[model samples]
Target: MGYNNLCEIGEERIRRAGEKIKSEIEAENAQLTLDSTPKKVPDIGFRVLRVDDSNYEDRRKNVGSYSQADLDFDVDITKSDRSNLDLLFEALPKFQLPYDVRINTLSGDEFDGHTVYSVDDGRLLACFEADIPESLVRAMAAFSPRPSYALVSEHSLPDSAARTNFVEIFKQSADSKTGSTKPYII
Candidate 1:
C-alpha cells in the first residue's frame, strides 16, 4: 500500500539507498583494484511516535467549571486511542529519562496487569498499569542497578493506602543500597 505507514516507506527507502551506494562503490573499486578500501554501510533506524490528542482531558477547558462531576468525568485521564507506546513516550520526559535511551518490555513475572518498562536494563523502570500490585512495587523498588528513578501513573494507582505502602517499599529499598532511586507519580 502506498504511504500506508511511515515505517514501510522509510525502510524501503533505506534499502534502496544502500543498494545504490554499494553498486557505485563496486564500480569505483574495479578502477582502484588493490588500492580500494572497504566502505562501511551506516546503520539506519527510526523512533516512531504518533501525534494524537492530549492523553489528559483538556484541563483548561474544564477550568472554572471544575467540580465533582468534572473530576468524575475526567477520571480516565488518558485518551482512548493513546496506545501504551504513546503513554510510555509521553512519560519518558516527564520522568526526566532520555527518549533515545534503550527500553524493553519487562518480563519474568506478571505484575497484576501492569506493563513495566525497563530502561537501559534498569537504569530506570516504570509501571503504567492501573491498581499496581504491592509485589510489583516491591520488585521495582528492589530492581538491581536500581533505577535513577521510577514512575507510576497518578491515575493508575489511585489508592492512598497502596501509595503509602509503595513509599515504604522505596524507603526499604533505598536503605538496602546507597544513592537515590527516585519514585514519582505522573
Candidate 2:
C-alpha cells in the first residue's frame, strides 16, 4: 500500500468506474440536462502507463578513477525529456503516499511562478522546475498547512550558493515550527 502504487491504482479505478457509469447512463438513454455537467473540470493529472527509460541520466563509467578537473564539469542528473508528472509518479511510491491521497498543483504568482505538487493536502510538496529560486523554496517551506515532506530537484538551483541557501531556508523554516520533527527534504 505504498503511496505511489495507491495513487496510480486509485486513479485508474476511478477512471474505469467513471467510464462504466457513463456507458450505463448512455445505455439507459436518460435525458441530459445542461446542469448535469459542469463547464470547468479540474485536471486529474492522469497519464497512460507505459514502459520508459529511467528519469535520470546514466553517468556510470568503467574507468577506475577520474581527475579532479574531469569531475568539476557539470552533469545533468535527470533526463531532458522527463516532465514534472514523470518525476511525480516515480517519487510517489518511494514516499509511501496513500492510495486515495489528493494531489493539487499550486502554481501562478502565489507559488512564486513555480509549479509545485501538493500531495495529500500539504503532507508532501514537490517542485521539479529546472530554475528554482530562494523565494520559491521559502514559499514552499512556509506554505500553509506546513508540508511534512518537501522535495526539490538538486539541479534546479542556479549555483552552489543557491543550493546552500535551499537547505538553510528549510532548516530555518523547520526551526520555527512548534514540534521537534522537521520536514524531510529531498
The lDDT per prediction is: 0.73, 0.72
Query: What's every prediction's RMSD, in angstroms?
Result: 6.1, 7.5
Query: Tens digits of per-residue lDDT for model 2 on 83-163?
Result: 887877777777898445688899999787789999888888898877787788888878888877788776677676887
**Each model's backbone clash number:** 0, 3
Q: Please report how far candidate 1 places residue 112 from its true position, in Å.
A: 6.6
TM-scores of the candidates are: 0.69, 0.68
Q: Pick the candidate with the highest TM-score.
A: 1
Q: Which ranges in model 1 have alpha carbons more than 4 Å from their true place?
A: 4-11, 15-45, 60-73, 110-114
Encode model 1's per-residue lDDT on 103-137: one tens digit a residue.
88985665544578888778778887777778888
lDDT of 1 at 47: 64
Query: What lDDT is reached at residue 42 by model 1?
Result: 45
